[model samples]
Target: MRILGLDVGDKRIGIAISDPMGWTAQGIETLKRQSKEKDLARLVELIHTYEVDTIVCGLPRNMNGTYGPKAEETRRFGDKLQEHFQIPLIYWDERLTTVSAQKTLLQGDVSRAKRKEVVDKIAAVFILQNYLDARAKS
Candidate 1:
């Protein structure tokens, strides 16, 4: 089954898609958020295009394993998405996915501007891959 992963933020939402077998995740695009209506519209288009059966969203929990404001915002957004699409939604703890993505880009010698452009999508990949890995192990 194809799965869509999202790293949601106030300004932009990172997008990723899993392979049909759910063995790998690929970065898609960084969606610039305009409004709730617009964002959901764009997501609906993606979900349809990719034939996504499940959604894995990154929850920005604190390092101490506590939910913070950002996590709450992500949950709210996920709730809206679920209400709109009626799709199964799963939240993956994403504490340092962005930092990990940034370091990976730096290691690859990507320029700052390029990193800025792709970091979100990369983070989404990390989130999705982690979830896939954990599920596989279990």
Candidate 2:
């Protein structure tokens, strides 16, 4: 019951994976975007390694909960993943998740330079953990 979490952005994609029992999520790495084929190939390697059964993608929305162009782009990428992997994929509202990650890093006293390196991966962890928590609640 492993699940993969993604915080996809224009320049990079953060990656997280749940435990085999679907208990917790941990940031694995951040993939620097390249050509589409390269990016997908990299994702394929992670998916295979993790034996992911599902994908939880973060969908960035406006403050008022409106879907913006960014949201549509995310949906398209997620659709590509779902179709290619033949696995179920769901979107979790990602409003402020990156901000939350940044705050957490600040509180932890991580340097700004270091934070920039890992913020997206941490954001992926937050997104995945939130989804897991919601599933547990319901």
Candidate 3:
């Protein structure tokens, strides 16, 4: 099944998608947040474009396994998404996906300016890939 992954943050939201077979993940784009309505509109368009059947949202739980304010915000966003789309939504632990993405880009010698633009998307890809890997093993 086609799945969409989201790395949501205060300023931007990272987007990723899985193949129809759910074997691999691809970075889609980083969306700069303006307003909830606009964001939801764009998400709807993407969902239609990709024929997504499931959504995996990054849940930024603390390293010690406690839900912080950011995690609460993510849950609120997920609630809105679920209410709007009525799709199966899952929250996957995403402690340091962004840091991992940044390191990957740095190792590739990507410029700092460019890395800022794409880091979120890359993090989304990592989050999705990790989820796919765990699912395969189970």
Q: Write down the worst ten-residue block by lDDT for model 3.
A: 1-10
- Model 3, runs deviating above 4 Å: none
Better of 1 and 3 by lDDT: 3
* lDDT (C-alpha) at residue 112 in model 1: 99
Question: Which 10 residues in a row give candidate 1 its minimum summed lDDT?
Answer: 61-70
On TM-score, the stronger of 1 and 2 is 1
Compared to the true structure, candidate 2 yields what TM-score? 0.97
- Tens-place lDDT per residue, model 2, 1-138, is 689999999999999999887779999998999987899999999988988889999999999999999999999999899878898999999999999999999999999999988999999999999999999889
Q: What TM value does model 1 have?
A: 0.98
* Model 1 score (lDDT): 0.95
lDDT of 1 by residue, 1-75 (tens): 699999998999999999999999999999988999999999999999999999999999878899988888999
Residues 38-63 of candidate 3: C-alpha lDDT, one tens digit per residue: 99999999999999999999999998
- Any runs in candidate 2 off by more than 4 Å, and if so which? none
Quickly count the clashes in candidate 2. 0
In order of lDDT, best first, we have 3, 1, 2
User: lDDT for each of the candidates?
Assistant: 0.95, 0.94, 0.96
Q: TM-score for candidate 3, please give it.
A: 0.98
